[model samples]
Target chain A: MIPAAFEYTRARSLADALKAAGTRGTKVIAGGQSLVPLLRFRLAQPSVVVDIGHLPQLQGIKRAKQGTVIGAATTYRDLLDSKLLHNTHPIIAETTAGIGDRQVRNRGTIGGGLAHADPASDMPAVVLALDAVLTLQSRRGKRSVPARKFFKGPFATAMKKDELLTEILLPFLPQGAGTAYESFEQAASGYALVGVAAVVAVSGGAVTHAAVGITGLADTPFFAASAAKLIGRTPNKEILRAAAAAAVEGVSANEDIHASAEYRLHLARVAVRKALTTAAGRAG
Target chain B: MTQTITLNVNGQALKAQAEPRTLLVHMLRDELNLTGTQVGCDTSQCGACTVLLDGRAVKSCSVLAVQAEGHKITTIEGLARDGTLHPVQQAFWEKHGLQCGFCTPGFVMTTVELLRDNPDPTEDEIRHALEGNVCRCTGYQNIVAAVRSAASALRGSRRPGAAVSGG
Candidate 1:
């Protein structure tokens, strides 16, 4: 089947993209890995397709004094290959490696993936775990949204119709902090059935702080606030198990053909435990 | 909104008129007649339409023809030169890597990108790299062996230059 006909325009600059995006029915194409499949299914039918894959402003990864800035158009493959990300945040690489196979990673952009907000996507959970901030741009100007606040629901976000996600700002972890992501992937599709991303900071052999993000068990990926309360506690097996149990306390686990709501919660607990254990082991 | 777009496919610059929504796979199979790239699953999950865009492997079904303008694309047809098959292709042939060959082109093209990046890969690496591609006929043991064989063959031989020729 073919997608419905649409007009295509490649934006030369951020300004050009903003202007083109002002149209009501314009759909921005960054990597098109997600959007194209939607188009093919006619799940998305826009009057125009604005191509921003070539925009210079939306490319590259850089380290700033405050944090690491990753351009919106940076592909998962690029993130996997980034030496800076590997050294500073190997969790991003570990998470991306478990994303769809090489072909999808080659074309799926971090910004596009997050903006698409697939409930099962790996980036949102990892970014949420890292406490990353998302920058959005429009003709009017730019604004920042914390990763936790950006996602509203499955395949939904807080992005305005005319806005584009410009960059992701991830603060550097404190020295000796360790981060890890674990997911149970659906065999054929590779979508996470239940996944967890954890960032743990240990000091004097106890957990100083921990950030846990949970996905595939709810309508949206969310930071596990209950799990974060593990701060300043010793991450012994018993305590970590208790924290993992609390990780899904507030989540209304999604029920689908893949897994029942009860089973998903079970997987969530298991994933959280593994993620936190691995993260704590790596932490100082 | 049909427009003339030029594609540098398999080393030849060619122009075709298509709508903005035209997928790269359709343009390759229908317009350019480069049908080696299959569409096993129209969705992007099956890597049947995998191809190299500017030297990176991507599912062509998920890329619009207009979006691929001015980029180098290498399909399975682009793998051979002077009657000699690329090392990856030869390994697949020698190892009996394929059955019901619908998915072979995608595997071959994907392996091209894999070996280009990591010429020497372990068995686990090869299996992991094949995450996007699915071969229903073979249980993937032979396919894994083929990739290992190809990696060794390429590492030992002069890497095939991605030369575009008129087909």
Candidate 2:
């Protein structure tokens, strides 16, 4: 399973990477976990391959005034080993740890995963629930795109051909906020059958803020508007169950050999309930 | 087109020419003649092509040969020294961890990493760590035993002055 012949350029700097990416038929390779497989399958055939996995500029997690800024090329292993992420955003680490086996985590990067935009990928729903802001860079300049608006469909994103996902900005959870991620994964590939993420903030024994992100249920990961119903109300068991039932109210479910559309919708409802319950319980 | 690149395999700096699509496993076996790394389930699901990239285990088949030019790669062939089998290898041999021996190299390499990071792992931890590597022979019971035995052996082999906490 060899990829088609292509020119390979190892970028010496961020500038070098951007210059090379500006050319037509150029694909930026970072970590190469997803792109390599696509190339081998002939699903993607680019004329030139720009290697940015080793670029130092896209390689670290930093704490900022607003939240945490993660370099686009930082690997999942780095995220699992980060104490800072564990303290501030444990959900990110928890979700990342279950992405693939240890070997895959060693090479899979966050930016590549998001840019690939596989509906079943774990981080898309996570970032959406976290309200992450993605920064795209090109020769012209840089622009920010909220995570909610990033995914257009399966294996598709808002990124331009020449634009690179440089950084992911995750806003800090508000005070008294807690987050949880739940998924029923396909046994063989570890991809989500139906994954859900929830962020809940409780105040005065009532839900003050809530956000729910769902994946593996449709062509694109999306926020469940039904979660808004929890705000300004006590999140009792009955209330949680009702909100979960409306999770996929208007959206069509994705179906495949792994699960039927009916079963997938059911799993989505159950996952949403579980995630919301876990998150609300952890809320301080 | 082929590009000449230098790869550090088993502590040796070897120069070779490979295409942009050449996988690391192919470069190690076909180009360098290091056949210890096997290519099972080439789609990256089987960990038969597992190798250490800078001391961390990764699927070599999924990594481009050009991507490994500046990094150190430790394959199964690099484990033994002075004709003595490494502790993990010895444990696997003693515990009968293999049936067909096809998946041994990948399992051994992954175990080396597991014990290095966690010198003492529970049975559940060992199983979880080995989820990537598949043993079609259903020899997982002995594999788990081998990892446990290797963990004890490696912990004992640590420096005499090292503070021993758990076994």
**TM-scores for candidates 1 onward, in order:** 0.97, 0.97
lDDT of each: 0.89, 0.90
Reference-based TM-score, model 1 = 0.97
Off by over 4 Å in 2: B161-167
Candidate 1 local lDDT, A1-284, one digit each (tens): 78988889999889988887677888889999888988999999999889998888999899999878999999999999999999888999999999888998998899989999999988889988999999999998999999989989989899988888999999999778888999998887889999899999999987888999988889999899887688889989999999999988867999989999999999999999999999999998
Candidate 1: interface RMSD equals 0.8
| lDDT for each residue of candidate 2 in A112-171, tens digit (9 for 90 to 100) | 899989999999989888889999999999999999999999998898877889999999
The lowest-lDDT stretch of 10 consecutive residues in candidate 2 chain A is A17-26
DockQ of 1: 0.86
Q: Give candidate 1 regions above 4 Å deviation.
A: B159-167
